[model samples]
Target: MRLLDNIYAGERVSAADAVRLFELNLTELGAVADFRRRQAVPDERVGYIVDRIVNYSNRCVACCEFCAFHADAGMIAPYDLSFEEIIEKIGELVVGGGTQVMLQGGLHPDHPLDWYLDLLRCVKTSFPHIWLHSFSPAEIVHIAILEGMSHGEVIGRMKTAGLDSVPGASDLLVDSVRRRVSPRKCTRGQWREVMLALRDADMVSSATMTYGLDETLEERVEHLCFVRTVQDETGILQAFIPWSFSPANTRMCEVAPAGGVDYLKTVAVARIVLDNVDHIQAGWLTEGPELAQLALCMGANDMGGVLTEELVVQAAGIHTRLTAADMEDLIQNAGKIPMRRDSRYQELGHEG
Candidate 1:
């Protein structure tokens, strides 16, 4: 099947398409997908950037078997960021020319919904112009359950408290798989409901899939189809970000790790399948810096972030950090222009 025709069909390509995508010469696949994206979004140029992930709390009850970042219940000192501590972090972020804040953390077992609300309000009231791109669907569901609030009400309160958007982070969007992997977190249906609610409220979010962890290729494609189906319903999902599952200190896949070729192949298929989503972000955090740079040529336009600090993937034992200048260098090294961007991909400026 021709790439353009496959894209125009506006449907999820079959497993055969995924296999074909996998078999294509890497350069050939890159050229075809890049060309298609250009035709659809002509004015867009390179250099999509998001700010650092500032994890405020490490305490969590959702002790996912796949996670290495969750603090155990018997830890000596579990610190939640005091308002002043959070403000200090934000002060550094702003002065460093950061544009957005990705505030995610473990599900602090005992904190009230108001605890999150107050922190959000403090950040927004202090820096109203900064994009507060925070929270995942799992966190939302957990918070709602803890607060005894409906998902919609939780989103409303969050928006009122200053949430600019959600991260769409319900990893492995298939229920049977999730039930085995992250049973304590939000189920697939619950995650979808949360995203639907955010979409209904006119918020933009990005969907993600972390593969290379006990799921077959069919399951991977199924996950892509699920995200596309949601996009068809709500039309508010902004991007699709597929990251390889990191098996560092996690209980699952203790020795197996996702390779670069696998990562690129997944990106190629994602570009072919998720025709509705405008942007595809390469997870620089999960796949090292070099692979992330290579991802630009392999169908990913956005190299995820100028992440000043990130602990989620780091705790899982992958440490590939990049500054704003470093990202500009990576884009240039990949032979594409790097254009600095905000949460919505509005070109704020160019770094190089």
Candidate 2:
């Protein structure tokens, strides 16, 4: 009762309290989270984005254990998308009414910083209106290492090259889990440095958490608290996205995927604790439409993106897709108005 009272009084849920909240009955837990959600977003509208993901290359050096997406430097044939190929993809997105494009790829050992800059320039110069939400912190760190520049310098160059925003990806955000999942990736400090650099550059980004690996409940809270604290200090995170770790078709196939109920509880807890973060997204690309709908009742206010073209999670053997109409219908059925938005959560239109 005290926990519920504190939450209702608008007090921030502590890391310890957040972990304790997990032990409550799932339905009750969801209700408390829903109350917080209503407080944050009083409007009956839920947001969705029409977007596509374009992989610039498949060659990677930081081969994470949980990822089934990248082709190792010598293990498989590598492919890099040419300017013509990427332009064709952007053309497809424009034809589909997509206003945003997610540009991401693994760290290739050969490509210089200019190559990445050229890719961003090619898209932004051609489609000046499209939002280029590209690159992860790890990717930024890789570019900095290759170019012998500071993180701030790399971000400045990226912005000048037309990079609009970054996806909160890579590094588990907890050093223990990060070492377990992606040892070759950048450290937690390195990732945070990149984020601070983004904030200094006056750019926006989303924060993400991939749970259900070897992390404990307390560790999960730590991940959320870390991002919440960062939001308090930087004020640059536009949203928060939490998804389950896909364990199939990777070196961690022996591990089981997190159940649907766990995903719901996670969404609820995220809303309860991340008071500073405005939006909490239901990762429908991995959670599917039905589960994502239920997540709306729990705390999620956004349905992520339409994911016109996605490959990373698919490579992990979890395949799901949805159209703009499908997403709108899902939100309507969940008793919320469906709003089409861009990466910045600015509503483009209400009609599909």
Candidate 3:
């Protein structure tokens, strides 16, 4: 109760307090988190984006144990989309009134840095109006390691190639958990460095957490605190997304998936811990639309995007897609105005 009192008094919650907040009953925690959400976003509007996630290549050297999407180059015939194919995908998104495109892929060992640069150049040349929110910290770090460059240098080149923003797709930001699950992926420190590089480049990005990876509650709090510290220093993180990890068709499939109660609690706790971040997104694609609607009422103010094509999560045995109209109806059903937003969280327009 004292913690709740301090939170209401405009005081920031400590890491220890965040860990303890997880112990509170779901309803009580939601009440406090919803209160904070109202303080940060007072309007009755919830935002969604019209976007697509384009996987350029599935050939990856970083064989993360938790990913069912990455193809093993030796066993599986890895596929890379040619420039024409990728452009066609973006063209379709453009025709559907999409304003953002997230181009993410695995760590392809064979491609040179120019391959990625040319891809960005080609996409920009074709669809100059689409916001290129592509690449995760792991992808950026992979490029740096392959090209013998620093993270900042690689991000600088990416920005020149018309990359609008980066996505915080680091599965979990705990080094121990990373070792257990995605050992070949970027370390927690490397992920933070890439984010700092984005800040230095004057770019914007969203932070994400994929929980229920057999990690402890304290580890989850640590992840939230890590993002909060980064935002406090750079003010670059625009949104915080906490989603349950899907374990189907992956090496970690035996791990029980997080249920609806855990999902909402994590979202609420993230909202309370990440006081500096502006937006919290409901993970509709992973948790289903109904639970995502509950999350909006709990603490979330964003419904993520109408991802026209999402492969990674689909590979994990979860499939959901939404048209722009469906997004509006879903938000309206939750009793909030659905506003169209760009990648930068800039309001486009909403129907009255």
Model 1 scores what on Cα lDDT?
A: 0.80
Instruction: Say which prediction, candidate 1 or candidate 2, comes out ahead on lDDT.
Output: 2
User: Per-residue lDDT of 1-352 in model 2, one digit per residue for the tens?
Assistant: 9999999899998899999988988889999899999998978789998888998787888888888888852333578888999899989999988999998888778988888889888888899999999889988898899889999999998899999999878435899888888887888788889889999999999899999887899999999999988888788898899999888777877888898999999999999999988899998888888889999999899988887768788788777888888889999999999999978898888774
Error of 3 at 36 (Å): 0.7
For model 1, the stretches where C-alpha displacement exceeds 4 angstroms are: 1-12, 73-77, 253-255
C-alpha local distance difference test of each model: 0.80, 0.88, 0.90
Model 1 Cα lDDT, one tens digit per residue, 225-328: 88888888888888888898777767774648878888987887787777788888877878887888777776678877777778777777777777788888
Judging by lDDT against the true structure, name the best candidate: 3
- Positional deviation of 107 in candidate 2, in angstroms? 1.6
Poorest lDDT segment (10 consecutive residues) of candidate 1: 70-79
Pull out the clashing pairs in model 1: 46-339, 47-338, 47-339
Q: In model 2, what are the clashing residue pairs, if there are any?
A: none
Expressed as tens digits, the lDDT of each residue in 1-352 for candidate 3 is 7998998786899999988987888889999999999999999799999999998888888888888888852323579889999999999999988999999888888988888889999999988899999989998898899999999999999899999899888577999999898888999899889988999999999899999999999999999999898888889999998888888888888999998999999999999989999899999999999999999988899998988888888888887878889889999999999999988888999744
**Which residue segments of model 3 deviate by more than 4 Å?**
73-77
